[model samples]
Target: MPTSICKACARLMKEKEDFPRGNFDSDYCASCVDHKGNLKPRDIIRVNMIRYRVNNTGVSEEEAAEIVDNLMRSLPAWNKPKTPTT
Candidate 1:
């Protein structure tokens, strides 16, 4: 097999390397990977947003709400939860 190169920066891609590792490879170099690992924060948020939308596909509102609830439950205490009142 031919050594697949990064389309972005034209560098050789090694096994278990690079980010956004799905169908499309990046143009970043190995040095760039070292300098700036995987996805940026904004990019990560964007990807998560895309994933969230994709996961919502065919899911009901109640199911989506439950998913959000579960995610909230798993978060750290820095995030405050709403308390129930009498």
Candidate 2:
């Protein structure tokens, strides 16, 4: 039998998994499915920073502090990648 490979993670699947009302088809494995399910921390940070900046425009200090705290709790999932030398 021919197998379908995921374009994102390149995992093979035998058939499409079906939902109750519709079909949610994918060639990726379960791990890849779970991995892509949520936002990366950096991405969350980037969005929250924008939101905080907008919400803090001449706002109350307490509100601004709250926004900053909410943004800070979303950090620490990423680190700079190290380059390999020949």
RMSD of each: 13.8, 13.7
Q: What Cα-based lDDT does every candidate model obtain?
A: 0.41, 0.41
Question: What lDDT score goes with residue 2 in model 2?
Answer: 39
Best by TM-score: 1
The clash tally of candidate 1 reads 2
1-86 in candidate 2: lDDT tens per residue?
33554332223445444211122444333333344443334444445444545675866656655765564443222222432312
lDDT of 1 by residue, 2-85 (tens): 245542233355654443333234544343334344523333433343455457676655665565455434332212563331
Worst 10 residues of 2 by lDDT: 77-86
Task: Give all TM-scores, in the order shown.
Answer: 0.26, 0.25
Q: What would the C-alpha RMSD of candidate 1 be, to one decimal place?
A: 13.8
